[model samples]
Target chain A: GQQVMQIPQYQHVQEGEDFTTYCNSSTTLSNIQWYKQRPGGHPVFLIQLVKSGEVKKQKRLTFQFGEAKKNSSLHITATQTTDVGTYFCASVTSGTYKYIFGTGTRLKVLA
Target chain B: SAVISQKPSRDICQRGTSLTIQCQVDSQVTMMFWYRQQPGQSLTLIATANQGSEATYESGFVIDKFPISRPNLTFSTLTVSNMSPEDSSIYLCSVYGSTPVGNEQFFGPGTRLTVL
Candidate 1:
C-alpha cells in the first residue's frame, strides 16, 4: 500500500512567523498537489507540481516537488491569522486516479 | 475543478442504522471519489465511483459496508450500511478533471456523521 506522511502534525506560530510542512511518500508519484482546509470547511486545491524539482509560488506561499517526485513541501511566509487551518499534500500515481493524502499538518497562528 | 455539493451536511444516527449520502456536481465528470476523515485524523480514501460501473473499493473497504452508485457522470451516492459508533466520521466527495492550471481535484463540503 502507498502512504504519504507529513511532518509536524501540528504547528503553532505567531503572526508574521514562517511555517513549513514536509510531505514524503513511500513510493514514487507522478504528481503532487497541495490543499488547504479551513475549519469546518472542505479542502481547497492550492497548487499542483508535475515536473521533478519543480517550485511554484502563490503570493506568500511556496510549494516544492522533490527531484525524485516522491515528496513535496509547502512553506508559508509571514503567516497571518487567516492562514490558520490544516494543510494537506495529495499524491497521484501514474496508474491510478485516486489520490493518496498525506497526514495533514494543522496550523494555528496566534495574533 | 468542479463545483460539488453533498446532501445532509451533518447527521446523527443510532447504532445499527444506515445512511446514504448523495453527491452532485455542477458539470459532468469521469470519476468521483469518497473519503473518510475520522476525528483528529487525515483523509482516507474509501472508494472510486465511475459512471455506469461498479465502484472500486480500497483495501479495508467493501461494497457490502459502503455501497456506491454511479448513476451518471455528475452524480453518485455512498451508503453506509449497518452503522456503528465507529462509523462516526466526516464523509467527503471529490471529483478530478481538467482545470485552468492542470488536472486537479475538488472536494465538496463534507457530511459530518455522528453515530451513537
Candidate 2:
C-alpha cells in the first residue's frame, strides 16, 4: 500500500527556462531512480540516488534525494525542446525488488 | 545496461481477442517485469516473472487475465486475454541492470495495443 505522488503533473516552459518536479512517497525507500519517457518511446533510465540527502547532476539536469529517503526531485536548467517528456520517479519497496513508480510529471518545452 | 527487445511493436485487436507480447533480453536476468501505461499516464506494474517459477502479479492484476510465461532466464511472454477497449495501452518489459550505485531498470520498446 505504498504510493508515490509527484507535483505539477504537467509543466510547460519556454526554451532556456528552468523546471523542477517533486516526488513524495508514503513510505521510506531504500533508493530512488529517475526515468524519462519520450513521446512514442519507452522509459529511459536517467539516474539513481541512494544515499540520503544525496545530489547528482548530468549536464543540465540535477537530481536530489531527501534526507529521509522518502522524497526526491529532478531539476532541469535551460530546458530545450529535447527535454519534452514525462519524468517519473521510482523506488524499490523495502525487502522487495518491485518498483513503485511515481505519478509522473509531463514536461513540454516550447521553442 | 541491458538490451531488451519486444515483439509486435503495435497491434489492433478486436474485443474478446487475445494478444501475446514477447520480451527478449540480451542477457540473463533474475527477474523481468511487465508494466502497463495508459494514454498520458504513469507506468503501473502488472507482474514480475521469474524463470522456472510462477509470476507474482500486482494488486488488481490477475493471472487469468494476464498470463505470463518465463520459460528461461532471457525470455518471457505476456498474454492479454479477452481484450477490451479499456485494455488498450502500452505494455513494456523491463529488467534490472547492476550499477555501481544501484540497480537500474532498462525497458524495451513497448508493445502498443489498441483494442476495439
Candidate 3:
C-alpha cells in the first residue's frame, strides 16, 4: 500500500516569520502536486512538480521535489494572516492516475 | 483551469439516510475524482469516475456504499448510501486539466454533509 506522510502536523508562526512543511511518500512517485485549503474552503491547486530535484517558486513561496521523487517541501517566506490554511501534497504513482494525499500541515499565522 | 461546481453546498441528514452529491464541470474532462475530507483532516480519495463506465474505487471504499455515476465527460454523481455519523464530511469533486507545464487538478467548492 502507498502512503504519504507530512511532518509537523500543525505549525503556528508569527506574522512575517518563515514556515516550511515537508511531505514524504512511502513509494516513489511519478509526480507530486501542492494544494492549499483555506478554512471552510475547498482545496485549491497551487503547483505541480514532475521532474526529480525540481524547484518552483511563487512569489514568497518556494517548492522543491526530492532527487528520488519520494519527497517534497513547501516553504512560505514572510507568512501573513492570509497564508493561514492547511497545505497538502498529493502524488500519483506511475501507470496509475489515482492521487494519494499526505496528512497535511495546518498553518496558523498570528497577525 | 476548469470551473467545477457541486450541488447542495451544505446539508444535514439523519443517520442511515443517503445523500447524492452532484459534480458538474464547465468543460469536458478525461478524469473526474471524488474525495472526502473530515474536519481537520486531509483529503482522502474516494473513487475515479470513468466516463460511460464503472467507476474505479480506492481501497476502503466500495461500490455499494459509494455508488458513482459518470453520465458524461462533464457530469458525475456520487451517492453516499446508508451513511452513518462517520460519513459526515466534506465531499469534493476534482478534475484533471491540461496545463503548459503538465496536468493539474481543479476542485469544486464541495458539499458539507452533517449526519446526526
- TM-score of the second chain in each model? 0.97, 0.98, 0.97
Model 3 clash tally, residue pairs = 0
True contacts kept of 3: 0.86
Instruction: Summarize candidate 3's per-residue lDDT along A32-74 as a digit string, tens digits.
Output: 8999999999888899998999999999999999999899999
Which pairs in model 2 have colliding backbones? none
Pairs that clash in candidate 3: none
* Cα lDDT tens digits for candidate 1, B22-91: 9999999888999999988889999999998899999999999999999999999999999999999999
Find the candidate with the highest lDDT and give its number.
2
Q: Candidate 1 chain B: worst 10 consecutive residues by lDDT?
A: B96-105
- Compared with the true structure, what per-residue lDDT tens digits does model 3 show for residues B61-101? 99999999998999999999998999999999999888886
Task: Please state the error at residue B77 of candidate 2 in Å.
Answer: 0.5
Find the candidate with the highest TM-score and give its number.
Answer: 2
lDDT of 2 by residue, B1-116 (tens): 89999999999999999999999999999899999999999999999999999999999999999999999999999999999999999999999998886789999999999999
| DockQ, candidate 2, vs. native dimer | 0.87
Q: Which regions of candidate 3 fall more than 4 Å away from where they truly are? A: none
In model 1, what are the clashing residue pairs, if there are any?
none
Query: How many residue pairs clash in all the candidates, one count each?
Result: 0, 0, 0
Give the C-alpha lDDT of model 2: 0.96
Candidate 3 yields a Cα-based lDDT of 0.93
